[model samples]
Target: MTDPLGAARIAIIGGGIVGIALARALTLRGLGEVTVFEKEHRLAAHQTGHNSGVVHAGLYYKPGSLKAELCALGRVAIREFCAEKKLPYREVGKLVVAIDESELPALAEIERRSIANGVPDLRRIDEVAELREIEPHVAGVAAVHSPQTAVVDYAAITEAMAQDVRAGGGSILLGQEVVAMTVEAGRVRVRTAVSEQVFDRVIACAGLQSDVVAKLVGADPSPKILPFRGEYWSLAPERNDLVNGMIYPVPDPRFPFLGVHFTRGVYDDIHVGPNAVPALAREGYRWLAISPKDTWESLTWPGAPSLAKQHWRMGVDEISASLLKTRWFRKARRFVPELRSRDLVAKTAAGVRAQAWGRDGALLDDFAVDQVGPVTLLRNAPSPAATSSMSIADYVIDHFLTVRAD
Candidate 1:
């Protein structure tokens, strides 16, 4: 039988959730002969595996933006996918708490955004009694609760998507990194260490190395990636009672990162933290995992100076918290006043976020994509990327791939 997609070859760089999800979507639609190349031997080796596992409830994103639209659709798609696959999907809920009256305005803004984003079953709790009813140990002047915000294993989800890709006759190549690429006659010639192939189209969902991949396709490198490592601290099993579901702070409007928070995982293990700190390497999970080249590139980037000038105070505070357990503990204890110092027993594995920043020293707040000839580069996909993976795939296929194909 002839191939329905007319033997059109497609390549997806990166084995992360977004990449796998894209390949799965394409193959399911019989779009082309799909193949995914992952540099790591295992899928979800980076961002997909190392995350807080919280399914955001469209609470923090700007309404009408791609992040807002995709995240809203993606969560429902993820829930259904899990149900279909018999995977664990726990709607443990999430509460954004304001510890003082000073934070009420920011809290109100969050409530407004949540309502705008259409977060399901979102509630605004003004009275402390009502807040305490949801979380008895929580001390807050006001809070916004999203009962449908949930948690799941993203790595497992990626693997499940890979299965769908294979079942649909798509190929997933592990340990095959695309080292070079050249566009010729409206097609892309991709080269790896061991082999080379040409493709009708290529989409790079490369997370940490997204900018680097874009550079290979001769795309603009204005939005360089700045790796920020977020470290998590596991809460003591006995102290798990301090948090019912998830307790988050009113994030600073100046930055994109949500503040340090507590999350109760799908397995019922509670963890506190994910304090954001600048990582020395793209895949740096620890302070000691330093790469001289990566560090030099970041330090010498044009945006480095202005970015530092803008966020130096926050950088210092975050770094201090990362170094001092007491400082980290204090941040977590703000919402749950009953939290003791001993409640945080050990540190967990860290996850490095690939935050995209412009040459003007401004962090990109929404999901960003760029097109280079036949290549589509996902320049920036943070926070909700995992949550929005499937929807992102659908968006890419519907907007970029299918449009060009037509």
Candidate 2:
């Protein structure tokens, strides 16, 4: 299956969920000679594997935008794909709760957007009794229940996609990281740790290392990727009863991440956490884990300074929460009062969101796609990416295919 002449139909850089989704999509569309390169020994080992597994219902994005459209479409597609594949999943739903009166406006906005995005089952409920009825221990004056929110093991979905790609005549190479990409004439030369590959079209789904890969081939990577490590803590076995399902806080409009809350995993475990703190490394995980070179580059970047200047207050608060585990548990306790400090335990698998920020310090609120030269780079695709993977594949392919599609 190696492209001996360096003439591949398409070459995907990463083997995460997004890359696998595209690989499958292209093959399904009858485009073979496709190859996916993975640095890891197996697929979905990074952000895809570490995600919270929430199949977003398109509640937070602008109604007519790509984020909304793709997620809405992708959610349905993913649900069907899971059902067809017999992958374990649950439409356990999620609650976007307004912990206080001031938060109600944000909750209302979420409801409005959800309705606008064709999420027909959104309902707002007031009265603590009702909130407690839905999730007995959760605290809130009101909540927006998105019945469409579901959970699944994304890694499983990615594995299924890789299998489909192989069955459909695409070859996926693992343990091979794309070191460089150079477009020569009409063909793209993709150099990896192991060998060189030639492709007509290349899709870089490098996730955390997307900027680096994109820059290797001459793309304006203005919006530098600032890896925000989202750390999580699963529930102590005794605290499993504290959460029935997903309980998300109303997201701050200024930020992209949904604050720390409760999510009952599809694997029969109820866990909470993911405090978004500025990560020292693009893939930073633990407390003392530091990459001085990356840290310096990230901190000294103009975009980083501007980004900090804009979101400094929120950044400090998130860092504080990360530094003090008690603060994280406190946020959870607000939702589920019975969730004590002891209920929190280290859950190592965490996703580092590839948060793309503009040079002007503006957070790219929606998914960003930039067409540079012959390559189409997926600049920013954060949460709900797994949910939106299929739709994004169509979108990406459709954009490129329509050029000569007349």
Which candidate's TM-score is highest?
Answer: 1
lDDT per residue for candidate 1 within 6-26, as digits (tens), equals: 567999999999999999999
Candidate 2 Cα errors over 4 Å, as ranges: 1-8, 402-406
lDDT of all the models against the reference?
Answer: 0.91, 0.82
In candidate 1, which residue ranges exceed 4 Å CA deviation?
Answer: 1-6, 254-256
- Compared with the true structure, what per-residue lDDT tens digits does model 2 show for residues 316-385? 8888888888778777788877777877887656668888877776777788777655566888888878
Span of 10 residues, lowest total lDDT, candidate 2: 1-10
Residue 340's lDDT within candidate 1 is 87
